[model samples]
Target chain A: MKKLLIALLVSTFSFSAMADGHAEWWKKAGAPYAGTVIQGVAENTPPGQFAGEVLAKDFEKLTGIKVQLENTSWDQMYDKAIKDMEANSGIYDFVYIEQDIVYSYLDRDFLVNITQSLKDQPELVAPMVNMDDFTTFIDYFKDGSGDVFGMPMEAFVKVYLYRKDLFGAADAKSGFQKKYGYPLAPATSFAQWRDNAEFFTGYCAEKGMECWGTTVQGHTGHPASTYEFLESIGPSFGLYNWGVTDDFHSCVEGGGSLNGARAKAALTFWTSMLEFAPPESLQSTWSEVASTFAAGRAAQGWVYGENAAWIASNEEKSVVVGNVGVMQPPTAPGVMTQAAAGEGYIGYFDGGAYGIPHSSKNKEATLLWLQYIAQSEVQADWAVAGARITHYSTYDDPKVAAMDQIADGYFTLMQNTGYLYAGAPMYPFHAAGRAAIDPFTYAALAGEMSPSDALDGACEALDKVMKDLGYQN
Target chain B: MNSSKTAWLLLSPTIVILIIVGLLPFLYVLYVGFFNWMPLGKNKEMEFINFGYNYRELVFDKFFIDSVWRSIRFAIVTLALELTLGFLLALSLLSSFPLKAFFRSVHTLPLVIAPIVVGAIFKLFLVQGLGPIPFLAKELFGFKLNYMSSEAQAFWTIVVMDVWHWTPFVTLTLLAGLSALPQDPYESAKIDGANNFQIFIYITIPMLVPVLIVVIFIRMMDSLKIVDEVWMLTAGGPGYSTRFTGIHIWKEVFEKRTYGYGSAMSVLYLYITIVICWILYSVMVSRGKANEDE
Candidate 1:
């Protein structure tokens, strides 16, 4: 009975204190929506898991609203969110909007305009939830007329991660120099990347180390293959957004350059890298690629920033905990200059936001939830947990700054060169376009089709789809 | 009159459910197959058009045709292997033997597991480097087997997993049929001084025709709808080499959200399945009737 009394006292004191701060504003503004149940659908990524399982608890405590965050796989997340919104079922109040799919969602008018929403109800906007604090990733979810449609939650870029220990070894460095007549370091160009892959793969084989030169996400039959090609590899080779032209044509007959010489060359180079990757490369996705590198079976690979922190610091899960290095992906001759000039992207800038669906029954409640997540104070803990941060202020936080050493300069690289980043194209038919390319890309990886042929086939299909969708004459 | 009215009342709920759940949605699918319906796009409402558009697009679609062919080929391969292996296992278990009941129980275990679970289990077992099966193959045979990577190997791997999981079901069905066979024909054949092999061929083979037909019919239907294993395993890739029609339709409907095209494909698939089933039934029945007459 004494313990129970203490628990009740603590709860009362905490609520009274919380009801005094910025949360006090929420406690007042959320008077009508309190105790209402709202739900969100999100993938099982680091940031998503933290938001769903951890932050949702704090959100309910602060606002007296119940939140159910359904954490699931990527496929199921998309299926459930899209199906519910399309059916106008009002099942989900908030949906995680991937950076790549922002175009599709905005084009469909499926998301509520948060800027307009906040304007209409100024009281609902908490002082701590300032939109100006977010990074430029917020632009990915904005309309042409400058209406903000979503709150940027997580933002990350793909980087070339290498084994510092292997590169720093005296013997390996001297041997690489002897064989390739260059210093062994992180690759700065595609040619150098290939050379390093070859040298390391052969060296590992000679030593019977069971390690490969690099890892590739070249799953022969999944959408990951298409993603790796269009987002990561093609951008480095100076072909962006599957090489679709401004008018959205993808074939020569339609006056587009999707199957142009540069694209074919990029596809060729990407497929060639598969030879030096592990045998599992043919069946590996991003998750497997990360695992392969973390297992110390690969010397270097382009892995998502989300995995960098855990792979570099978590000893129980990763073998090369301390010996990790990060850098921007290698670019072709003039591509780096263009990318640096902000004319194009050199690598994949991947992230997502949370937006309220128009079909949501609890729009006001969901808005409060979004605002709660948008606070800069909540960002530091989320960044530490997920290795993702969208608020520019979170970068200055001492705790987040300390993660640089463990993440091997991941944040530093992202800060220094993140402007030269890109993501999926602004296409409403994004999924359809990917479906058209995935088969041929997988076939190319499997050596069933030549790179040029695969590009030709993919573009031809895309052209037909574009015409069918009335994108072109 | 009271009894007839009671029977009508009893059937009304089932009729209502069928109309609500089954028939209505089916009609809706047919209606949506014409024109464009972008549920989440600027065109939130449906735009009606002539039916020729969806059909024309599908008719020339090489990808759709390839998926259909792949599904049929997988169905045929699985059916052939399951029938042969199932028949052999059933024949062997016909004789009284040690631990017969234990073997029977063990053989039925795979049938109890879900197809998706089987797929997930084999996905792990077939991982290129870390999987135990690949590790053992390398250690024992001095050769590598990358099942889920190579095109032919992945396709055959899925087939092998299915055969392993479902062949026991066929064996059980055949075993029950074999147990129920009459013994008078075999006795007369033995009394006429025919050898054991002749008696078995003339009596057992002729008597099991009806049971074999039933088993084949059931197996054909199930194997043709092979979606879960492939979806879990390769997802019809390395270049659509294993993409059956069902996966194609699923991607179209769910991933691409091309409901109009997907519904058209569904209708076409339904028609094709019905035609093929009818043909198979006619052939099998005619063959059985001819054998019985002979």
Candidate 2:
């Protein structure tokens, strides 16, 4: 009787202490801004959805701050946030800053320096929020002084997704070997990719199956086509930063290779794949391509990593759920070496971060909300929910590791080879550059101009845009 | 207070609101049009450009000019088709028929739907592999019909969509006009042994000219400023074939963030539209007067 009473008392005290320890940091950090409300805006992507629906609720429960996150379409999110910021309306406390646009945000001085803010307000800093917990992707959100401006919520690389069921079929293996003198496999080079595209298209046709070789995200009227060519396809052919040199020029005369022979070849290769792609390729964007792959319409293609998790595991939305395979994007010879050496990248690493706007009125409260989300404890579930990772620890989390198996090692591949991928170059003129080159890219895809002529025209247009923007004399 | 003072007091709020919302923005845009001002980045500093600079850039911008021409073409084509179709529809509904009220109500359904929703409906109906139209085309006709596969097809698809959505508005307006037509002229024509075709060509068309002018003016203005449906459909693609002036200006102002240049373009576009409407009004007035003299 005496021992039982003593054990109960000891366990009770330990439980209370653990509970107190868990609540202590939040209570102290959140006491000042307990009832404050902060608003944020983000695109309605999977990651954004997770942050808005799950993480926001969790943060609010821990801290007394009310977080209202507006998840909207990609275009509308940018449009609303930019309009608000431009007008200094202070409508959004924090906004989603895409990796591609962070440079522009930094140049405009539109975001608060979170590192500096935490340093300045040491009282508000949470013990769990350490900068080293985040992956090197945090560097992408930093300004020139290496002070973090945005808190990365999601980071992913574009990858080559192939249908393992199709590639591993016995008949396909035998026929590909007979025809190409090699075993059927995921492509390792552009020529092999073309061969695979050709073989699978014919093979599917012969079997009377409603399948295609690949999905070409070549919407002639949308920006997706430009992204596929310039960011994904162009980089594989050794064309980086839209072939623009450090001097902000894209033409050969100005020492840029935008219209160089390799760029022309890259365009030709991409345009040629249209023949083997579904007829809807001309109208397809990134979303459509993912649907096409999920429907088992394409054998292989470059797919965004955001969709990889669901496409590989969700049987309801995906027909080839367990059959999806991922690999590094095929690159030209020596291009891989260059990317590995940090000289360039093979494909796009796309993601976004949440940044408190300079115009935000509730900066201190919003800062606490951000740090709450940034805690290492919240990341594993977020990564599983969104197929994104911003911390090294997320890869080791048992949930993520289990998901990695179901996703055919997508998470593992991202962790192992993510350095080979790069985000958009740091250009404050990102939109201007894309707008200038979009017309030519569209024309080339529509077969209105030859690949060479299209690149030549695009180079000239980019040069003119740079000049108009006062970047050059 | 006297009657005038009371009226002024009542009207002051509306006038003040108008100045604050409408007049002030217009004046601000006009002022901004002559400067090289960017709202963000290092270019946020406002630099005063010569007035001719923006106008010159506008003149030389082939894409903007092409988009303007496309808008003009779209306006003319949709107006012609809508006027003809709506007039025919109104004429058909003139006499009493079975379920006449039901037919009229059902015909006006498209008009009440928002333009963006209409675009989405059409997009769902025509999208390849998923849409029923392509499926039916392949299954029934033994050939695929992908509307977005070609530039001509996409352009015409937009035209057809606009005509389908707005023709009901025209028909309803004309139906009201036709209902209110003086019966004395028709009776006189019948007594004079006029045929149906003759009656329609002479009395019907002549008397309906006023309503037709109203319809034309309204649709012409609306179609010139068309953006939402087209944007939802193509986003001005297939090599800028459907990039109308509204979209062009929107891209400049919003997407590219060239505020001053977009302002210049908008001002010029507004001025041109006013001039065109004025000329059209003058021509119609003269024509009406000439008919009166005759």
Candidate 3:
């Protein structure tokens, strides 16, 4: 009885001590800016929604600082933040700087260096916030002098997701083997991927099911289609940076491979897969493709990692819960070796970081808020809620380890093979480059032009845009 | 003060407001359009190129030129269809039957709804598998109705959406005009033993020309600058088939951040609109003068 009483008392004291530590830290660091209201804007993805809805409220309650985070669509978020920064309106205290656009933000000197800010004002720095706790993904948000600009909030790779129930079925295994002269499994090569797609499409049709072999993020209008091709599919075909050279040339005559044989082959392969995709493929963006897979309309597809946790576990939102499997995307010959050697990537590592804009009126308070979110204590829950991990320690959290099982080892694969994935190329003209190449991509998808003709036109357009931007003579 | 001074004083507030909100911004855009200015990037300073550089680029920019032509085409087709259907609707409403009030109320509902809402509604209605249009198409005719399947289908779908949205406004305008028409011409036609078609061609058509001109002018301008509904629906897709001038300029300014080029495009678009309106105004005045002379 004495031992039990002692144990209860000790546990109570420990819990209170932890709570007091957090309270005292906030009481000290956030006192001067207690009444300050910081505003931010981000794309309304899972992570962004979590930060806005959950973390903002928590931070306000603890620190007495109001955080008004606007979660908007991708286009509107970029437009609003960029316009605000350009006008120096100080409307937003912080903005979501996506991985691909950070280079441009750095070039324009739009973001405040967070590392320098914290160092220059040590009193505002929370003792618990340490930069070393973050994963290598933070490296993407650093400027040329290695000064950290944006604080890494969410990092994830686009991964291959397949319906395990369909692939593991006895009937499907025997049928696939008989038809393709191999054992049924997740695709490991482009030929195998096509065979699997064709077989499943036919098999499901014969079974009188409303299912397609794959989900294609091939929206003819949105930039998501261009991203899918250049970042996801093109890399798998041994093409990178849309086949543009480091010297800012994109056409074959300018010694670039954007219109080379490999690019044409990649385009053809991507377009041919449409036949095996759902009827909504032509209208499918990233979100639509995730929903299609969750609704059981697709058997396999490349899906953003943020949606993987829910699709594999959340029964209310996903019919494929407990039946989803994830793996690295199938790559062409030598691509895997190159990726292993850090020479190229096999797929897209897509995420974003929150950065304080130089025009922000409340930079110190915003820095504290960023540090609060970046604490190792909050990362595990954030990862589980958003299916994104930015801190290296988050991978070892007990909750995350448990979730890895439910997510079919998605987190584990990300941790193990993340080096093989890469973010968008370091280009200050990312949006311009994508815009120049997008119309041809849409035309090819809509059958208005052949793949060869589309790439040829796209390369020429890209070259012209680069030259006009003074990147080339 | 004298009566003329009072009149000018009353109009001064409105004129000042217009100058501040409209003319000033227009002037600024004109100034900006002469430079090569990108708000973001290392080379963001406003560099003055020649006055003709932007205009020359516009002439050779096949995408921009094609989008402008598409807008014109959309305006012509939609205006023609809306006017014909609206006239029919107005004539039918003139002689009411059962549930006429309900029909009128329902017809105006589309106009009352926001353009983005209309786009969202049609997008949900036409989506494959999830939407009812494709399901019904399959169930009723065994035909798969995928709007995003082809450029023509996507473009026509947008046209249909525009016609549905604005046709009611056109009907209401024409109805008001029809209600105000004089009875003398019709009585003269009936006394001369004229048929309905002949009377419509001669008396009604001649008398309604002014209202018809107004309706055409309004619809032409609105149709040519369409962005919201079409943006929400197709997003100028199925391979740039429906990329109108407004969408093109929006992409340039907002998406691509080519503010100078976008301003130039806007300037050109405004000039075109003004020229077109002037021609219509000239025709209306000349027609009125001829009638007055008679």
Candidate 4:
């Protein structure tokens, strides 16, 4: 009898605690949709792992709806989700909408109009959850009519991460200075970046260190290498939107700037720097680049901010923990000014959102699940765990702010210098366009083709693909 | 029930399954092939063009043609190596040995592994810096080796990985055939004072032809549709040097959402596989007749 009484008291207290803050509204509004099992799929990244392990459980407890989040590999997730939707299989209630893929998904009408769904069912919208609270990254998932189709779960910009220890060492810095005849520091321009690449590589080689000046995401056999060139490196040199103009013209022919002098120059510069990179650079993906940098194999590289926190702080995986620094990527001369005029972005802003699929049977339940994730109280923990934050106010969370010292002020750079970054171009033929141009970019990296020839071939192919897709004549 | 009616009832389940799972999908593909089918989005509708547009697009698609040729190349190379190596291994194992059972079991290990798992294992083994292969090559040979960076390296790496994974399968099949062979012919050949090589050529090869035909057909069909192993390794990359027909069709159907065009590719791939099978069938028939004539 005493045990039963204690159990009752425990249950009552737990209920009251859950009903105190944003949880109260969720519990009340979600009651009608209780016991509905909703399924979601996402890539097996840090954020996906967090959602699968933590948020999925928390959501079930708060809403009485079972959430099954399957974290699949990058390609498999896209394949499964798209197949499920195409078949009208109703297999996935929610899917991870990558920022780059929004154009393709929207073009296909594969997503539910989440904004309209929220407005239609006002009670499902938690009080703390507001459309305005999210950063402009949410705009990536919005259609031209301004109706959002997904809830932004993670947002991060690609940034230049360098080894602070290497730069701080007196001998190393002086040695770099002696070679380059400039004060050795984080690069401010492309010329300095190249000089630093050469100097540090030569320095490390001369010293017999097991390191290179920089790691390269130049995997010749994969699309990732091509992505690095077009998104991170090309944009810095004023190549915007895959070097294609809005009117479907190549930059080289003075249509938009894709194969233009600056873009071609950027491509050449990007590929040429591979020489100073580690031997593994030719086969390195983004993950390998991060690992190489963390293992102290490279002095610097353009690392996706998603990897910044763990690489800078995780002691088990990162040898250079607490010894990393983040900065904006170096740009070509006058490119920064052009970027300021909104002509280009510094680097790719890479992240994904949880979207309700059109094939979902339990739309209301899924909406509640999305709203539960968007709550301000829940943002801080998820941000710290996933190294990504969607809400504008998440930066002010003490836990996130504390991570500043660890991530080398990555969070601060993202928020203050957010304008300089952009998500993938909103092309309807996003993946197809990528496929069309990737091989040429890859050929250039493999020394099979000159940068100019590669760009020209890529531009020609893009024109053909665009025309084939009914985008152009 | 009458005997005929009962027989029909027993086979009904299989027939129904065949119609639903097999015939329906093929017919659907044929039907969809006539239209410009975009399987998703606002333009998610099939527009009828009488199959002209899709076939024309496919015919002119250099990527698809290149992928087909690459797949054939991989098939021919791996098939030749596996058959040769497997035959040699089977012959060596035929004679009584001290650890014959242990050796036989070990040889069949690769057959049991999933292709995707093989791909993952090889990826860990071959990745330039992270993999031990490169580290060892650099330390022992005083030269760095990268298997996934260069176009040629990637193609050969996938080929080697496929051979390693599948050669054991061929060896085990041939071993089973050897075990099932009649001893009368071998004993007769031995009594005739025929050498081991002469016996193998005259008796064993002829007897194993039918089994060889089956094994060859299975491997040929599977190799033509290879995707998972190569995808996990190179993903038809480094400028499409290792791109296979299966991966190309997959990209079209799933990634590009070009349902009609992908169906056309699939149908074309099916026709090509069938034609190759027919040619192999004729060769097998000719070889069997030759053996019977002897």
True contacts kept of 3: 0.53
Q: How would you class the docking of model 1? A: medium
**Local accuracy of candidate 2 as per-residue lDDT tens digits, A320-420:** 98899999989988899899899989999999899998899999999988888888878888888779999988999889999999899999999999999
Clashes of 4: 5
Indicate the TM-score of model 4. 0.93
The residue pairs that clash in candidate 4, if any, are A108-B41, A109-B41, A243-A258, A251-A257, A251-A258
**Candidate 4 deviant stretches above 4 angstroms:** A1-19, A205-209, A251-256, B1-8, B39-44, B190-193
Q: Which scores greater on TM-score, model 1 or model 4?
A: 1
Best by TM-score: 3
Q: Which scores higher on lDDT, 2 or 3?
A: 3
Chain A TM-score for predicted structure 3: 0.96
All DockQ scores: 0.51, 0.52, 0.62, 0.44
Worst 10 residues of 4 chain A by lDDT: A249-258
lDDT of 2 by residue, B1-294 (tens): 999999999999999999999999999888889999765324678789987789889999988889888988999999999999999999999988999999999999999999999988988898876789888989999876666556787799899999999999999999999999999999999999999999987888778879888998999899989999988888887778788999889988887778888999999888877777788778877777676666
| TM-score-better candidate, 1 vs 2 | 2
Q: Give the higher-TM-score candidate: 2 or 4.
A: 2
**Which numbered prediction scores highest in lDDT against the true structure?**
3
Better by lDDT, candidate 4 or 1: 1
CAPRI tier of model 4: acceptable
* Residue range B23-86, candidate 1, lDDT tens digits: 9998888888885865433454678779778877888888888888888898899999999999
Rank the candidate models, highest DockQ first. 3, 2, 1, 4
Model 3 ranges with Cα > 4 A deviation: A1-19, B40-42, B283-294
Task: Write the residue-wise lDDT of candidate 3 on A73-129 in tens digits.
Answer: 888899899989888999999999999999888888899998888889988878877
Q: lDDT tens string, model 4, B130-212? A: 78987898899986577655778888888888889988889988988998999999999999999989998889999999889
Candidate 4 lDDT tens digits, A304-418:
8888888888899989998899999998777777777887687888999999888999999998888888876678777776678789889998789988767888999989988
